[model samples]
Target: MANEDRPRSKLLTRLHLGTDEPLEVVPFLDDTGHGVFATRAPSRPNRIGLSIVRLAGIDGARLSFEGNDMVDGTPVLDIKPYVPAFDVRHTERIGWFAERLGQLRGKLSDGRMR
Candidate 1:
């Protein structure tokens, strides 16, 4: 956890479901498959991950937080203060995730890749 008071910290980490192998690219941009880059699935070439969470509280060395996506014991690669100017974006198309928006509320990690 960070030493300073960063109420909104975005955790950059190496996702547990990712692998150390090279990523094979799909043939063409017009391909209809679920391209690796298009989805936020845990698998990636470099295994880097990101999660924006709210800091609930802080004491000596422990931290209380909310909106944690990664599992317990997830290794954090970096922590940066989220600046709206650089991070926020206005877009209408959210791709495949938009179709699943209604199903997210009760969704739970199935631990399939891990």
Candidate 2:
């Protein structure tokens, strides 16, 4: 929240970006190295929330989307288009997650950020 709080800026359009979790700092306090950066945890040191929901439609000021993983009233902070050429990477090695890849399919957020 800013002192000159206003509506979502027009600069952000048809983009996917970060928001503010606003509820807690560091969703998983006991998490090891790199903290929230190591995981897709909602709450982080900067309170920046991120989602890659599809931009379904835009009616004036209203934006309709699908596949949202966040809750209601999440404050958007920034936005940018999902450019596959710049974003996608074919990598087999991911730090810390290399060994935990098998568990991802069954894993779920347990409200640690709330």
Candidate 3:
């Protein structure tokens, strides 16, 4: 397979989980039910994280992107092209996030997880 270096703006990256105790469940924002898998809580059992970032540019061996949610120096496990057809899902049931959608904008992470 030819390694197509075509400029793809979207990329899916697997990252090493940060330093946090593995939690089975946490109160969502201290108000909702946030079972570990139900919420994007950092402390997961597997200690692996997934993020979607915008591919900004390729400079020799360096790559930069926007929308990096991981901490600085976070180890990246893998990377793959983000194909919307396979990644995007149109589903009405988003579990707990469905009701909290309005709180997303301007909402910053509190140190509760720490």
Candidate 4:
């Protein structure tokens, strides 16, 4: 095996859910490629959260996803990369979330990157 076949960079991630949530990834089944998972339920169906966050900085990461929250049962799945040229959609028109994209600069843990 060669180093080139290995991942150039890697991510250390953790996905979380609240106490009221009822679900489990159990050996993390049905995982597609790689993504985040909230191991608990939500206050609303859409309220996802991070119990802890960290990013490996050797690749050009702008921020490490961490801080302001902590709990033991959180389940983090996978981590990817940030590529501005390939990731940003400059020409696309925004709907209701148009103004909200800026808030995404602080949001991560995987499922929202694309």
Candidate 5:
């Protein structure tokens, strides 16, 4: 099947060095102290990141995708078909995010990870 015809997928990528600090605790965008696992802060113990994107097309070894948030030349570690049945979770608790969902709409990176 053509790439565009395929379903959306997930990319496991190595974060660029700009946000690759191994920080145990970092202030989230909201200025709350949170452990690395509790927030999407880029300074994790491991510099891996997961991005969900729509497959736009492929030419030879290059992949085109929508919903890209990484910089160009970002190293992709792996790709997996996005199966909502397995990836989606019906959770009542999202920890701190549960109370902060309303603030997510206009939030943007402030370069705090660097």
Candidate 6:
């Protein structure tokens, strides 16, 4: 099928239903598909993987996500895949974020990232 004719894939926006209370998305800093922060603390945090979401194979991708912005196990409302063919840019900078990646990796591995 042609690109325009092909059906657009929709990401499954699942709420972390295994809880007493409901949580929603909290916008933070990042061009990456609107980072979702934790609205409230949960007994057991979990990740709601969006169909478009992917673990950044880049050196520091995970660290950025694991930073203080997102708490353990938050339900993401949406995700849009970064189509490198279109999203890639000739110029890009790691910014101040590169520094925090190490700390993020430590905390994030404990019990985060879906």
lDDT of each: 0.69, 0.51, 0.63, 0.37, 0.76, 0.38
TM-score of each: 0.70, 0.56, 0.71, 0.29, 0.78, 0.25
**TM-score ranking of the models:** 5, 3, 1, 2, 4, 6
State the lDDT at 44 in candidate 5: 72
Per-residue lDDT for 56-85 in model 3, tens only?
Answer: 667997777666666666666667778878
Model 2: how far residue 21 lies from native, Å: 12
Error of 6 at 112 (Å): 12
Q: At residue 79, what lDDT does model 1 achieve?
A: 81
Assess the local accuracy of residue 74 in candidate 4 as a C-alpha lDDT between 0 and 100.
44
Please give, for residues 1-114, the per-residue lDDT of candidate 5 as tens digits: 765666889999988764545555555446667768887765677878899898888899999888776767889999998999999889878887877778767765566533
lDDT of 5: 0.76
Off by over 4 Å in 6: 1-82, 90-92, 109-114
Better of 2 and 4 by lDDT: 2
Residue-level lDDT of model 4, residues 1-114, one tens digit each, is: 343333332333343442333333221222322211423223323444433233323346343333423344444444555444555567576443454456556554444212
Error of 2 at 20 (Å): 13
Instruction: Pick the TM-score winner.
Output: 5
Window of ten residues with lowest summed lDDT in model 4: 27-36
Evaluate residue 91 in candidate 2 and report its C-alpha lDDT on the 0 to 100 scale. 86
Root mean square deviation (Cα) for candidate 4: 13.2
lDDT (C-alpha) at residue 46 in model 2: 58
Instruction: State the lDDT of candidate 6 residue by residue for 7-84, as single tens digits.
Output: 332243444543533334321222233222432232224544444333323364331131123434454565455465
The C-alpha stretches of model 5 lying farther than 4 A from their native spots are 1-6, 18-22, 25-28, 111-114
Q: For residues 14-109, could you state the per-residue lDDT of candidate 1 as single tens digits?
A: 787565443443212223456667766566776788999878787987666677777777788888888888889999998866766776676665
Model 5 scores worst on lDDT over the 10 consecutive residues at 20-29
Clash totals for all models, in order?
A: 0, 1, 0, 5, 0, 1
